[model samples]
Target: MADALTGVSRALREAPPDRVVEAADRAIRSVLGASGTAVFVADYRINGLWPVVDSRQPEVADQAGQSMVQRCFSSQQPVRDGDAGGRCRLYLPLTVWGERLGVLMVELPQEPSEEVAARAVDVAGEVAMALRAADQETDRYRRARRRERLSMAAELQWELLPGRSLSHDAFHLAGQLEPAYTVGGDHFDWSLDDDRLTVTVLNGDSIGLAAALLTAVTVNAMRNARRSGGGLVEQAELASDTVYYQHRGHRHVATVLLELDCVTGRVRAVDAGSPHLMRLRGGSVTRVALDQQLPLGMFAETRYDLQEFDLDPGDRLFVVSDGVWGADPSGRETYGQRAMARSMRATRLQPPTEAVGTVMRELQAFHADADLRDDAVVVCLDWHGSGDREGG
Candidate 1:
């Protein structure tokens, strides 16, 4: 076991930036006496599981749609596939913490012992960490995964987001953007520092590349304020000041800035033209009313109100960009509050990660077969307060 661990570590650590996946695959196959090996990386941004490296056929690496990979990814467990009586393949989920990366495939010469299966799981995690590093340091693997060309604006917005989900002892939050391949300017970001969690929900109105630039500037300004120990209104103020002066008021960015005391479940918010902030409790969903102010870049003297509330255990908070509800205030063609209420009810029992995904899928079904789909975003937070009062 020590030798196997040392070999896997050396293979990934010593490999060149461009060849991490290939080296890991080689090491896995060698250690397990497998006839072949492969790794498929999931790029949820584009909804694809593309092949990075494969020793057998290149066709086998793109098997994300195959039943085995799908089962392994969703269940987040290792899958043994001699049940179908083919060549006896094993699929392992490559995941760390709460984040799901992709699938690892190992082809055995024969059915392996239980020890081999256990060891393969450990190696899969090391490979996942290496893949994360390669994704940042090298371009080869990323370029291979791009099945479609993204507009320069789309690329910027995609990078502005904090991955698709985040979880910890105090809260679980997940968010997603729609029309992911060619988004306008919809991004959500979050940071958990010490016991505080700050979140931003933004929607920029500019089109094309301008929208992307607007989002980039606004989100950074918000982060700067939050990291500097500013509250909700201060974050909104900084974002507005940056956009108004930098863009000369040429564009406006709508947003909701959220600050949570992760330990106490106390919630505070500043709304600068965000569409809605909904809370789900018991079996129903209701809008969390807040004082509204002009969007960033709209007014130099615009001031925001800091809204406050306390979330108990089992409470959910949702803030959405206009794209999710549509730009229409008239509510004729848009996804209306009634529809949203139903979805919140349906997904109330799911964890935050699954809840956001479920809502996105339902939104797509609501707009199915339509050529024009706007960029939509939703951030869902599930809060559980610290149990300091339990003894009372």
Candidate 2:
């Protein structure tokens, strides 16, 4: 098993970023004596999976195969099945941490033993890691994952994201944006360091390319401050100042900056504008009332203030931009007036990974299945508390 993994790692290192998938496939077949191997990546909307390397003989071409692949991706578990010819097909999720990339399909000549299955799972993880790294060097994999062309603004916004989901010992975090192909003006970002998890949600004051550019500047400015050992206040102030100076107060971003202590559940926040917060504890959902302040970049040298909150174990917190909370179809009632809470209550049983999508789907239904008039973003965080901390 170690030798096979080493071979896979060596292949990954030797291959160019755009051809890593092909290299991994050759290594897997040679080391494991597999009949065939293929990697499938989820599309931009995550609505379907596409083969990253060979498309001539795609493994998931049929509906049944697609369903099986989707099951593996969603469940984060390996699935094994045998065909009439007595060949065994193994489907393993290609996941890194909590992020679900897609699935690895391996077709063995015959039924495999438990040990072989275990090794295949390990190989899938290695492939996932390689793909994650290759993402920085080439856009090959990114192109394979997109089912449709993205608007220039959406492309920029998508490139600025950390990832759609992340997992930690103390928390599970997931987020999503709507009008996926044309999204602009709304975005979310997070970073984890030691015991601190910093999260920021932004809603741009403009639309199209202008909003994308405004958000890009603000996000990078905050990132610069955070990387320089700054806290939430510093991040917000730096971002606000940078945006104000660049646009001369003509453009702004509504934002909420938060830092959570993984060990103690203490949260410090700077609420600069929209993107309201809601907390779910036990069975009830309530708005987390934050002191409203001017949107970032609204004025030169705006001073931001910090607010505090504590997250108990099993608490679920959601940060949603105005596009969601203020969504009104055809000038009807706003979704947040009641439906957003109802949607949250309905998805209470789901994990953050699934809950984020469910809430977005509910919002779509609220819009009567029409294209959303504005960009929307939703971030969900489930605090499990620190198991290693005594009395946590």
Identify the candidate with maximal TM-score. 2
The local distance difference test score of model 1 is: 0.77
The per-candidate count of clashes, in order, stands at: 0, 0
The residue pairs that clash in candidate 1, if any, are none
lDDT of 1 by residue, 1-392 (tens): 87997899899999997988778868987887777777877765535566774454334633433667767776678998763545667888876555666788787767878998889888888888787777778887667666678788888887777666776776778887766668878889888888788888888786768888888998998888887888778888888988898867778898888889987888888889885788899897888888887898887756788888889888998887777766333446666457767787788777776677676766766666353356788889988767643422
Cand. 2 Cα-lDDT: 0.90
List model 2 lDDT by residue over 1-392, tens digit each: 79889989999989999988888878888877888887899887677788886753346688888888888887888998789999988999998988888899998999999999999999998999999999999999898888889999999999999999999888999999888899988999999998899999998888999999999999999999999999988999999999989888888899999999999999999999878999989889999999988899989989988999999989999999999999999788899989999999887888887888888999999999999999999999999988735553
Q: Model 2: clashing residue pairs?
A: none
TM-score of 2: 0.97
Q: Assess every candidate by TM-score.
A: 0.88, 0.97
